[model samples]
Target chain A: MDQRLNAKDFEDALPCDAPDSGPLRWAPPEAPLAMQKQVLETRTSWADLALVGRLFLSRRKA
Target chain B: MHSHLSPDRPTRLCRLLALSFSLIAAITASLLMAEAAARDGFGALDGARAALIFLTTAWLAWGASLALIGAPGLQRRRAQPDLRMPQPRTVILIPICNEDPLTTFARIAAIDASVAEAGVTADIAVLSDTRDEAAARRERFAFARLLRETGGEGRIFYRRRTQNVGRKAGNIEDFFRRSGSAYDLAVILDADSLMSGEAIRTMIARMQEDPKLGLLQTLPRIIGARSLFGRALQFAAGFHGPVFSRGLARMQGATGPFWGHNAIVRVRAFAGSCGLPELSGKPPFGGHILSHDYVEAALLARGGWKVEVDPSIAGSYEEGPDNVLSFARRDRRWCQGNLQHSRLLLAPGLASWSRFVFLQNIAAYVVSTLWAAFLVASFVATVTAPPPNYFPEAHQLYPVFPNTSTREITMLVFGVVGLLIIPKLTILTGAIASNRVQGFGGVIRATSSVLAEIVLTTLLAPLMLLYHSRAVLQVLSGQDGGWPANQRGEGLLGLADGWRSGRWIVLVGATALTTVYWIAPDLLIWLLPVGLPMLAAPFLIAWTSRPLTHALFRVPEEIASPPVVATYHEVCARWEMTWKNSPAEPSAGMAVEHHVPA
Candidate 1:
């Protein structure tokens, strides 16, 4: 729709999919979570432990 | 109000502003740290610290700019729905996974009754993915009890799957695979979700009016909080959430957010676009998509459907975790889901903003880990740093310590703190100016609530950093935090429970503090804000989990409960008594508030 489509345009094409049409529209790339031991441990949990803290407001999860 | 989003929302301008603010913040942080480090010859450690500080600061500034950009629309009035348009053929979907039966059913009953009163013609479906046979049996019994109460035999449906293949997403997919074609739209909600007829009506009208609008999400106000932690969260959602959401809306003009529950989706569009593909392998990254909502939003955007959020609708409500332990446990699962989304950042055919949203979601979780990394670098840099060269010249006696960096460091501290807080203070000011604080128990009480929320959240931030960091590690190591049932009505935890959950956290705090004191005592003050809280986390966790009865963090819902919220509790109360008084055999007419069709 280009996001250029407006609610006022009722004449626009309205295409619908079959209920059983199951070709997945999206797929994952290779395991992006897979990371090097050095990076994971250092970035998230250093050689021994990671010191983590900083207050910035955001709750993309919630 | 979520969307004043037009095709001409000036999103490019907002993006430019966001970019400029982030760059400025990042450069400023880097330069300030470099200036401090320059007093002693800057080492590799100093360089590492500067880079980490730059990245995290930029991320923080990006979040701040959303508030700045969206603050103006806080008090803007929403357009009324056209009542004359015929209500669309809709089905209200309540997806549950091993949730408590009576309570979950009670919420459904309230929604059903509300929709009925609103004169909306819709079928209600209780789509249960409960794998436990006993819980599934209880759901059926409670569903029958619900049917008897509402007298909605055929119009309401309850179905449970033998195998919960894709979890909640799969559960909804099962619905579409069976009866999706009969409805024009589907209102998807979680077990904890409840919406007023006004909110429901507004979403439906918006969808009906806009054919290309695939999904419309509403900002559900948190309610029914009995504990201090939950109440504080409720206040934040009611107060700060709107402005942030407005910023989100302004940034995301057409391709908006879909937060799993409390959203309406056009059946054809969703069925066409959101068939999530399991990744090529096993747990964590290579399996059923855990954060299906965001992906679905992205997919719809890919398919050219306008996804949006309407924050103006007032009656949407959901319950938050009443305590810290429950919140963190839930966060563990969400953290994994969000991490899994990093795979889709490069997915084919996604809208630009959609890809950015994925990036943003991953960044939200990853930023904590990055900040932690910055702290580690700073710690090592400070401890390993050589003694300052007091006499850089050939002359021996003259010491050369510069004090200019102290003032710059102070200014940097205030700048970072201001970036974190000024947006919220501005929102409160806007509220007071717009008389928005009237619903929050007047300006004094509302101001108190914001201040209290700030203090409580600041204390809890360290704990979240640890939790989030651990979660990222677990996911990276291919650990799957399985789908666990959400703990409702269970926020109370003993000090022992807190200790059991956070004992390692205590060790971490102790180690950092002790190490800083031993190796770099001068930097101890910098670490105390975070480290001290970690040390006392057990006590904070246990204490905050306890129930409270005060008006400090009072939200509007506390002042005047919505009709749907009132109805939910009423239905739950009546159903509970009837359920307790009647026989356990549900099919043998265990309880009936009204005559149910045989």
Candidate 2:
């Protein structure tokens, strides 16, 4: 019979309430296209604008 | 002809001699510049200009060195004797991120068919990192249709990661963790990548021949370039790129290049040595190494494995950005990633060559800023120089201007141009001599194409300089250019679009030229080359974005489309009909977003 290791029996397994390493890895967060556009329009800093203003200025929408 | 298993003593001597010659040329230029500076009373600005001249000269010399090393290898072809041993199990991994599924999977199918035709048993895995729900649905449907059409039920697999951790690198790592143990070799491909049956077999056989080889990268030629910018790049890659690659191969030796895709890796070696650990702190400097390919190669080399780039292998192909905006957009991500390698410069256990390669990668971006600074310093020197001192107080015997005479300056300029142009000419000459110019439409047409490439690149250099300078500035300011989906196969950029994308470039160019003119009109002659193209940047971009006249820059690939490219087109044609008839509803259990883990 194949034995299954329960959460309590495993060396590193966690309980249901225990916290895990946040996301396991850092991925560039994804958002909807609208949100991405909004962020590009608003969150982009002045330094960034001065450097690559063309990309931001060419945005089709606000 | 000759065995190139490893660069022999004479080849090594040739590399050293080439380096020495480059140094001598650079030193001669620097000495002349220094003499002129000394005559000008050698101020801080003059000193800065001198430094810039030295760095620029050395950089050009490196290219010259590569040309010297590559010239001899031009006609030398590595013999790949047929392997009678049983072929190894290989898995082709295609990682897609929001690409057109119909085309992407269609390419995969074509590659699969090629592999099958070669009698090479290989499993195909389409790893999806796509985030959009609609795109994911389309990918699944397209993939299902692919399996059915190709009869690749068990051989081909599609798995979309719920969380695309660490972007593409993470996606590959995830696959490795789950089921990588079953395969001996993993051939990685980008969505746009295609390889012919012969190229595939050669790569696998080469790896089999050298058990110490951990990774083998191919020099993928640019194909499917439609727009004028694309065609120019395609021409350069098909022509100049190979000679340059040969030199690069000789230089890299056991430590080699991995260009992320169209390369094969030893599965176990990659699984063990390339488990990337995130850098401490945030990005633009840290976090997941965005330029993972180079670092992975370095890691493999560090683990006592050979990573080599075989430039002689043909038929590997990929697409390039079609226009300036698209090119700049792609460059933004790469610039950030390469700059991020600064943190790993002194990381423990890296080979010395690996560290130097990292520095070279960093310099690839940093040199733009230096060039920009040099230009600024030159402007300052021009504007601030004291009027020509024909008489040096009462001590001078004859009237002499502190600044370099027009003739001397002209000579210096010509010297720099020689450094830049001579290598390219040598490569062209070598190509003709080696009977390799036939593919590029014979000697006459190839010569014309090379001249056109030079002209086009000269006009495009300043724009690239500005783009790279700005990118370096952004990276320094801690701005992370998050991974963006590559925009491919676009046609000519509209005038308005080009203007919008290149407005800042024109603005800066115009402003700089006006400033120089206002301060010192005589220097305008010196600045025209940099200024005029920049002022007309938007227009120039719009012009180059369109089709070239009469296939003026037509590369051999465009002149005679390869059979694989034709096959790809045929596959796409069939796909158009299949897509029209297939039902539109999302298949059951195919909701990509729903599979996301909490």
Candidate 3:
């Protein structure tokens, strides 16, 4: 959840030594920690698990 | 200066030979034990027991083999550190999550001062993934104070992410993508990590001279332990950590481990190779990788780069959980992380050794469950075994049915028990041989510490086994252990809390002992060592967590802290004093400025 930042959120981030002009130019743009976001490439697939699942389903049909 | 293939051939050959020996010996021992069981017509229960024995035995022997390979002496580094070289563009990155802001920032201030004192240069960055607004407010003020005290305006940086994407690993990756290309190298530190300037200088020099070295991991000695549990953990790590690491280093060749902190990594290489892809599954086996350090190292190795560990690099330190509950909590996360590697056992394009390392990581936790299963199987086997032929040969004069398997079974049990001793003995021998025992209070103290450690671990092993067993079952059942912030500087567990957490364990211990006594009185004696401790779980937990003011589990660090550590302690004290005396809370209004001690 992206927190709604406000005046109180930055309430006491007052700089002790440096000038307070910068709006805490702290971070670069946000980057997602998700699996690499290439739509087709980022599928979380485990080949072995998939194989076992197939075998289980096949057995059930029989 | 660092040539990868020219020198490591002998090390590789030795590793291969030892691993082969481990595998063959494990198989042989298991087969012999299985045959012994089948001597009197093996049942399905016997088969299951045999399998469990094999797994546990393999796990034990493999561990002992590492101690065999790792000489107790410091591992020699290939790249001769050239301190004359200009300091590279590097940033010491400390990624924190809801950590105690005052102490964590104090470490940074001390480290910054130490770096200046060494006449070296490196920037420090604190990447905060703290979610709570109140904690974030505390963190920002803490950073402001650190900057003012260190006069590190342009050099020091602080950032907090509102949307915490990937936890620590993601936080680090975010740093690299944002500012990593600006630096040639980066030193990764946990919130509790504190490294001296000299150590920083050495790592940088070694990294600069070697073009192919991707990461260099330092052995972060545990410091600042107060409770008996904390000190015992510290002593064990201080004594056994290096020898095992040295052994691990020799076998690793080009591919080494990344313990997530107190290590230097080539910025570009890590940026390129370690953009970790989240796993496909929902949790436990998927989403973000929990043990990202191991995977990162493997990825670096797969990318044809050298990753290494240099245990001789001292002055790097971190603190641990002070009590049993905290330790178990931290351990549960690690347990889940390792077990999740089952999905990656056959991941493509990995170094065979890397995959094997993954297996060993998984086995480290799974072996506990195997031990639990073995005990259950043993009980069932013993109970179901044909009743002793009381009337064999028309009422034998003595009711002794001539126990035949006693010697064989004892020898097998003895062999299994003896394997656990070999590694400890080997490490001690190496420590004594290399005259490295002095750092751990010389011969007498070190020996006693070892004995104390053995007792501590023996008493705690069954309790941990129960925890590990639960952790494994939970993970298998799709329970995800979210990345919880480490509970540092807090470890006192009251009797009630201990009982609340461990009542099931005590019940299990009592039930097992009672059942065994009624059915097979002889086996009751064999189970006493493990069973008794579980029965006293709450008491042991409470007692070990109490603060100790003794000289029992002292490491060299406790004898006299390093200059950096001393400085950190001073800074932490001042910060705490300032916080206590502050007239008003930050929310209230303007506050008095802190005056740091010179």
Candidate 4:
């Protein structure tokens, strides 16, 4: 239903700036190549995906 | 805003008119049909028989429509995914008035363990209204020790109000005012609530998903329903309760129900919108809101926030009353609280959907009254009407005698089947699909348990109906059925007290059925629908435990495993321990602490 947020829009909404200073990092390296491709193709925001991905990773570590 | 009820007034008037018209139509149709039957030399006996069939069919149709619409509405609402996520910092408030501290502490510890396992960091506040300095100190120290033992040292804290103020709501508000700014959300828990890790995580995620979501309530399954009556209640709740709630959810959507405990709310939402308005009255409907959950949900909805029930969510549990009287005691307070919502039905700005939910609550009360009336009517008809004809005067009376329409019979059969069987089938399906049947010693044992539960519930139904009827009468008459804090013990009822409270229903039902049977021997078969259940009440109540029922059923050893019995046993043990450890003295000092200042 709703439009997927873009990187710039997500960045503006973030409480703090990202540590990365590159042009724009859009996909996680550890994600499967197909998933990464879909992320890029779908215009999924990096921040929103990163937050969920990070939470999952933390859960696994715990 | 000018006081205007124009929009709602017209709708309310229309609804009343529709109800009146339908009732009048039903009466007219039945009377005319009876009159026509009488004129055809079909004697008064035949007319009475025709009337009975028509009335029964009408009752079945009414019940079916309610189930079809109401059940789906509840289900659809519960199906919505919770969107709230975990905030970094939050407060979990557990309000205790005069409850057992150890029991409360153990449950909190269980919840604390579950939350930590979910990796959600939050502070715990034990808001005690116990005034005694010594007892309060003891409870606080016990909580502190339990927290540290469980690796939650700084995260767990305690607070006691010097003054009780406005009871539970005030106790929470006091905390919010003092330390409200420190947390983004608050999890309000009852002293008895036991939530699992996954449930907590899901609830937090739901809150995170929707910022405007004020509350997320989980349907609580009964925990310690050990007695026969209690077990029947447990099975009913664990089985049929979800279907009815799932139906309610479908109708209410986001603005469903808030059942007080086992739910989470946003801090800002609580502070801004959930402050309860005191009613100008006395006991039963007044003082403080006895049942605050529904009113809180209404307030949250009024303040433009979503409040919902999620029945699919699991591991939120509460205990059921062990016997009929205990249930009546609890229901008396509930009846008053729900009846109070009659006023809220007309409150301004509520979504029409929420008002519908309020109406459904009232409908539940109405059903009790209607059923009682039907029982009385059936008794009167049995006494006054003559026996059925041995040889029908109109075997060829085509449309007049209309060979008991298959549609009506099927509708009646299906309604009974759906209410009794479908719920168990649903749970069995869920368990099988999830592969959680391992705990119950495979398929056969689980099936037997379902069968046992059905028989147990059937026998106990008459008793419950009678208890609820008395409760309805008390509520209607405005009697103060004071809060009989739930009995958490294994103390069996004294036989005399049990008979005094329980035997009257059985006597009345049995007496009516016996009268029907004596007058018309052929009617004996139909009387099973009412008679057998009443006769089995005492036996059912006596053998309601898992161990006892299993033994009585001669369940196979493979199915009646130690683990299954142990689960029930542990519940009993906990209740007994709670009772045995109650404070020795009146604890007058503690009483003073919980006394709310007028």
Write model 2 residue lDDT over B1-598, tens digit each, in one string.
1123344565466557766876787677777777776665788888778778777777778777777687754446779855446888788999899887767887888888888877778888899999877677667667766765777766788889999988999988887777776778889999889988778888889889888899999999987776678778888887888878888878777787899999999988888788887776788787888999999888887777888988888789998887888888888899999998887777666777788788878888788888789889877876777777688689878887454557657878998788778888998888888888888778888889889888888898889999999999999999999998877766577889878888899999999899989998988888889888898888878888886543455566666776677777778777766554544533232322111110
Report iRMS (Å) of candidate 3: 7.5
Tens-digit lDDT string for candidate 3 (B400-515)? 45446666677777777677776787788888888878888888888888888888888999999998998999999999988787767765789998899889889989999999
Instruction: Report candidate 1's interface RMSD in Å.
Output: 21.6
DockQ of each: 0.01, 0.01, 0.14, 0.01
- Name the runs in model 1 displaced over 4 angstroms: A1-62, B1-9, B73-78, B83-85, B402-404, B585-598
Query: Which residue window of length 10 is worst by lDDT in model 3 chain B?
Result: B589-598
Which CAPRI category fits model 3?
Answer: incorrect
What's candidate 1's DockQ score? Answer: 0.01
Task: Please give me the total number of clashing residue pairs in predicted model 4.
Answer: 29
Check candidate 1 and list the clashing pairs: A41-A45, B1-B312, B2-B311
lDDT at residue B109 of model 3 (Cα atoms): 95
TM-score for candidate 1: 0.87
The list of candidate 4 runs beyond 4 A from truth reads A1-62, B1-86, B130-138, B147-154, B162-166, B239-245, B385-419, B426-441, B494-497, B510-539, B545-598
Candidate 4's error at B449, in angstroms? 2.3
User: lDDT tens string, model 1, A1-62?
Assistant: 11222322211211113244233211111111111111001122353232222212233333
User: How does each model score on TM-score?
Assistant: 0.87, 0.85, 0.88, 0.67
Better of 2 and 3 by TM-score: 3
Ranking by TM-score: 3, 1, 2, 4
Off by over 4 Å in 3: A1-62, B1-7, B28-32, B73-79, B390-402, B584-598
Worst 10 residues of 4 chain B by lDDT: B589-598
How does residue B391 of candidate 2 score in lDDT? 83
Winner by DockQ between candidate 4 and candidate 1: 1
